[model samples]
Target: MKSLKLISSAIAMLMCFVSMAQERTITGTVTDQSNVPLPGVQINIKGTKNYAQTNYDGNYSIQAKTGDALIFSFIGMDSQTIKVKSSSVINVALKESSNQLQEVVVVGYGESTSDYSTRSYDRAERKKAKTAATASVALQGKVAGVQVQNNAVYNPSQNVVIRGAASVSPKNEPMYIIDGVPAKANQMSKINPNDIKDLKVLKDAAATSIYGNKASNGVVVISTKNELYKNLTEQELDKKLNIMPIPSEPTQEDYDSFVENAFESPRTAPLSTFSIDVDNASYTNIRRFLNNGQQVPKDAVRVEEMVNFFKYTYPQPKNEHPFSINTELNDSPWNSKNQILKIGLQGKNIPTEDLPASNLVFLIDVSGSMSDANKLPLLKQSLKILVNELRQKDKVAIVVYAGAAGMVLPPTNGDEKQTIINALDQLQSGGSTAGGAGIELAYKIASENFIKGGNNRVILATDGDFNVGSSSNSDMEKLIEEKRKTGVFLTCLGYGMGNYKDSKLETLSDKGNGNYAYIDNIQEANRFLGKEFKGSMFAIAKDVKIQIEFNPKQVQAYRLIGYENRKLRPEDFKNDAIDAGELGSGHTVTALYEIIPTGVKSDYLAEQPDDLKYTKTETNSNNYSDELATIKFRYKKPDGDKSIEMVQVIENKAVALEKASDDMKFSSAVAWFGLKLRDSKLVSNKSSEDIKKLAKEGLSNDADGYKAEFIRLVEAVK
Candidate 1:
């Protein structure tokens, strides 16, 4: 009897194994019509909680009985139900719901449908139908509040912005995130649009709060394509992947041709029409001629004329990469009182993947003023270390601007290390700073040997002394501005202690469409060149600008802090030709504002005079009852023919600040820091300690020292 019972049990077990094998499993990716993989898509058995989250790759795998029903549901997509009949592999495409917000929108850490907004775009439903190849093209005018400006120039790195201007601070631009990492917004344009699977803008306070102070401006989230093939086998992944930089360097022949073309003036008149003498001694003589009440000729060495005369030497192109230039306009928002017009410009996009090839023009200020060890001598040693890292393709051109600018070396290649080192060794300190003359000569050399696509930039290492002839800040600015049009980017590397002229260096860099970095030591130089070289060279977007219209009803009063020079007039929004700030690849700009609701019990402002001209209109008590504010932005591509792109955000009830995404929290902390840095009068019940705590909590997976440095900076100021 026992043997018979055991035999029956064994047979039952065998039958169960067969049934399990027959059940089968269906697994695949879910994408929208545009072929963009959809994440957070709900997948479950009908009428059951047996659902799974879409992995980062927008793929899902599940076990199902032969006839079990599987349902797919997404925020803006129509629900899809399929029966697990026979096939073990299944791929699904979802159509957007026509009556509802048909497109799934990515917020900071969540997804939402356009149905939540009254002014959502109708054609967003078709975004998924197109492939990633044409994502930016498809985005032309389809997304409400989203703009894609194309440059007349055909270049890949297009400038993009989210929600218009929110502040007039130095870095009052939106934040950019890649794979959940807070990257620099300027760097995003360098990334191939094809490499991106999805890109979303976080506008309103609700969406941006995850980024906190930084979110006050807005946030852009870019999900790359690599995340989609997470589950594929190594072989399959290899077959589906082709990751390579699009060639951007020009050839040697191309460089020679360009040089030949440049030398041949198109004008029938003499080349003297565009030429001017700007040597330091000549400039000083001209100034002396003027100061002595002597008549100066039209051909006299004026500051502008002198600065424009010298040729700048860019590195010769070793590859097929094209050199580029970018610029931005600095104006107040439509409703502000500041009127300091400014423009920022940058040139070239040096690829980091290539060997360390750079034509570094060191504009050192060795005037009597730079007699300190931390000044001229320190500058020399600091630059020497940078030279040590160069490869054969790299080269260094030393231009000392003190009472005059002169090229220390014509164009020494990196391979001739000893020659370059010897030139540095032979340098000496003397004379006043003929900053104007030095700048002109440096640019002259840079332009003369202009590298077709190599990393050609003028690194101005100085203590900010421009005390010689035509040394005024404005004169220097004008000189840099005119030269920037010629495509030689500039980087102001500030050194020394007192009278550093931080503001002047900042302006030179801004006008030159480059960056200004304060280097107090070797570590700082390494951080700028060694660690952050990619951010320093590759400009993804130029002239990036943002504008925000606050719904008077939602926000009673608001104040933007820090950008005393970048505010734009309301009318500038309609003008697409204006120059603005540029964004480097992976560079992020953050802005902040402290807002006060209408009914909130806070001392925002003193009672205004009833007869005040601008306050004559009755204050609308009904405005802030249901709305907060709206944000808008406008920007141009690095090489686009025209400006394109606009984004908007409407404020909503505040969520749990702690529950906000890392972006929102970190952004807010940044805003707080900015406010403290400027000593903004708008801090509402917030303290420096609070900001620090919030920043610590929102710190993302920051392996680099960026966030930590910010935290430290904030603490130091406190």
Candidate 2:
């Protein structure tokens, strides 16, 4: 009788535990100390991979068992842990952390980045740490498990060991991941110390286990601030580096006509495809307009171009591909019912010494229209800097055209620098514009001196006024298309302003498989010719295109943020013969999409359609699935024929705007400004004050002072 009673009691206790184990969704709101809804708060069920971030309004619904603990964490906020009881709705209020935790590490890969217990060195502590310039410079007592012993003599890095390698063959240095790419010991010495943000040495197995065998010797993960904020403009870099432009009253300039794209329904058009655009001429042109205290014309603002103007330091690719891919999804700041999808592609940067030899042809338009000081004079100075950068093996040929095209200098070796400069200086401008002849002659000269497996290109410097034969935009495009087949690339450098044919030059560069840059002054020329030389010469990937497919079950309506001119038909994605923009070394491309998730009732999306009588209605595979969309990209090696594809699927990860990184927040501010310039309905209500505030907070390590310049621009506009 005692055994039966005991067994019955145990069975009742098991049933009670099972009753509480039923899985159910827990809806909640996350707030800050002041009761403000914290955006981007990451909430996850502890001891499990299930996680969700709080949306813009601090509302989040995630699946969890009644007995599980939920973790609520953000960057600067103190994390809160709570266990689920009978209540299905859990609201959490997290206080700000008085002391900064080491949570700013770049932890991707679906990992719960909210938690890192290891001690880390912030900017303050890093300023105190000292190391000699020699090999004996090791963190012996500084770090817990790391012991650096450099010989005062030979092999300086030989004694630097992290955790004393488990098995050593004399090469057990800790893996150094600088800016997302693994660096060899010799390469580590070259890294700029100013670029680093946080330095953390992962010595424990718990910290190093994430890297597997790569971490056997331990790991040194150094994170750098975004690249977009690091690049300095020409005028900013050197106040005296600009060409002196004669002060003339601001004149109106005409831009190519274009229309803003409209929102599209996923039910009718499920695929959004477009060619990648890296051109930033529009942004600089607008800046030029502003500098002259002139009102920018609405038509001159190309949102996509403006967004791509600044660099965004995305991660470098670790795979065989030449470019890295990164994406972020969040609620749109301007629209409550919409979400913003950000996609970034960064091309690998090739060092100047490693870049291939070049065969360059300078196509100068010495036409009568190019007589301005900012036009022909600036062009000559720019070419001189490029000539100085050429290697001994490189060759250059100069071709000029006014009434007719003719070669000013034959195929001259890069060593004969003075000869090239003399030829360039002798050139004079005073005839009818024959741009067609110039292009044809330039291509011929470039082709004649082409170097196999090398950088072969023609740099066209012009005011974009072509009045002779084949001057029509379509005709010039066709001519460029034919010449590009010869494996010769083009780079169009626009000069002057009023009467500048921006449309014609843009077309020529696009069809000729090249890049377009508008050099308004001498400082701008230095930026192109001196600082960004290799990036302009060496092509890494060509014909890069992006195709996004949003799950109809998750998304209701979507609109691409920009790239109105680069939009292509869905079928063109697979066609290899279709020419697209080329990605030069160290180039970064970014694209944004405004998406509306399903179940969120909004006036922007189309009405739900009834079941069709002629066909079966599409059904959701899983109504409650968290998948939002899948983005795929296709890119070809600079000289390869076949294209490679990479795909990434995004979850419904919505974080508060405050939780986003400075890279995301600042880029969004730039995108928001573009919309403001266009007067788009999307961000119409987003005031200049809101954008400036966000941008101020988004300034990370503005070491190069670009972010400061941008903030000044914002204040000027306001």
Candidate 3:
């Protein structure tokens, strides 16, 4: 009887073991680079519907047989497929997808591959072009859809447009992105083009969709390069040397000579021949001020006005890098006791050892529409400034479109400033506009002189009129879109008034993957071309995008300040190949958000019921410790094969706005400015005066004239 009982027990034990072996339970955890558990991860069999989702702890368990394949997938992460070759338990450490996370762009309502879309010039071409042109002049005629219009003179703020304008308002310019952040349009001039690596324009719906309603105009994505400090070793850092170049000063003799010469020259000129009354007035004034023979105050020469009007060379930033400053005292032509001051300010020397050569073409409009004093004349003046600043290695070409397109000047060395200036001086206005033909000719010239690893850009200046060949807006747009494939960039500058074609200009710039700007005056020109040259020309990042995930428990509602046109969908922020914006060197972008805390006691909303119908019955367990939002940024290097970056945001307890950092304060001020401009009803109890005060407090020590100008503009507008 004992033997029979033992046999039964053995049979039962064997059956239990067989059942357990047939269906084994496997459990494991998944984590990210920070070693933090990733919840809501999807786990499925290689070829079956059997799947399980990870919990908050990133832990998952499933019943499966040995030799099965387990697939793990998550948003903004690459998928992982693991084969169950041995043990039942599996743990996964997912490496973030560099391309997937960094290159994705928000095209209108959809998404596309940003990697495939080629603009006027590629990375190699831009590098080569950078070598040929001065750092300030790096981005001429290189982009297709962009239209760069040089104010016939050396004015800094040339007209820049993206994919043409779609609105009737004067503020139809495309949005600007700097270092993966959206900046105010007027502030675009603050960026230094020389520090940029690449520029990308989001023109078509496919490229601007992520921004939804605000993107109807267009979008620009800028990305800055990583600081070199990341790879520096402690010893190497300690050994780092700083060098600053000091210019020699003029001798006392030189100063005295200049003053003597200045005292001897005549200061006044005859009044305009057309001004009959001015002639009599001048005589009366001369006689009245003679003081028995005091020279009639130099006959009201307007010398001071003229002198003040001219942009005098100002001291540039002195740094250990390549930047330097120089000043000189010249012999004055009209004064004796007072010396004539001449300042020769120099910027950092950009070595061309690894820089690219460039082939640039200027597509100008010599049509009647551009006859405004602020139009053609201003353009001529602006171009002259650029011409004088060109380096020997750069080549420039001129193409005018009016009734027909013609090449006024073939590719020539930038050193021939006089020849270029003469050509600009001789241009005349007549006939209708032929923007299409002009664009074609400009592209052809740029391509003909194409230098490998150089920048090739076509700058178009116009009133956005294309009344001649392929005049239809759509036709011109298609042509630009196709021409961009040839690796050429386009920069559009809008001119004239009343009939200004903001829409067309916006389109050209956006599709060309370049930047756009509006030139309201000469000061604006200097700001664009002179002060922000580095940021305006070189692009360090392209197709950049930003997305923030707000934690519901920590915040009730949040509104992004500015960048109404740059907001992107959560999913579209990860797709590469979607055309975005470009970030220039040394450009700093700021953004702000006003959040309404969940537990705050306020009457901003309508009365609520005591008994909440859909409210949660349980309060958040760790509300104090949870984050409010996660800010994510993605960007590509000027010549890099992919994109990368880090993200940080505020999440702990809600801090008062008054206690925010300096960056936050400046960003909030900018937001206030945008709200005032747009007259947004969503703005809190903030005024322009309040914004100016906040901005003054947070102004950077290195602020050039931007802060002062901001304050002045605020007062003027108010």
TM-score of each: 0.47, 0.64, 0.48
Among all candidates shown, the one with the greatest lDDT: 2
Put down candidate 2 lDDT per residue, 1-718, tens digits, no spaces: 9999999999999988887887676878998776878755677788775666564468776767778998886544567889999898999998755543334333323333233223222221111223323111223334555544332122223244666555312224677665555654544442334444555566546446678766777776655555322334433322322323333544545577888777777777888999898888887777777664566777778888887877777988888888898888877777867888888888888878888889999999998988765677568778888899998989999999999989888899999997787677566678989999999999988888878888999999998889897898889989999999888888999988888878888898889889888886666677777777877777888888899988888788889988888888999998999888888888889888888887787766556678778976474567646777888889887667888888988887877778877777778888888788788865646577887787887888666555656665565575
Query: Global lDDT for candidate 2?
Result: 0.73
As a TM-score, model 3 comes out at: 0.48
Best by TM-score: 2
Comparison by lDDT, 1 against 2, better one: 2
Stretches of candidate 1 above 4 Å error? 1-351, 354-360, 385-395, 414-418, 452-456, 574-577, 606-632, 639-641, 648-653, 684-688, 704-718
RMSD per model, one decimal: 29.7, 30.5, 35.1
* Candidate 2 minimal-lDDT segment of 10 residues: 120-129
The TM-score that candidate 2 achieves is 0.64
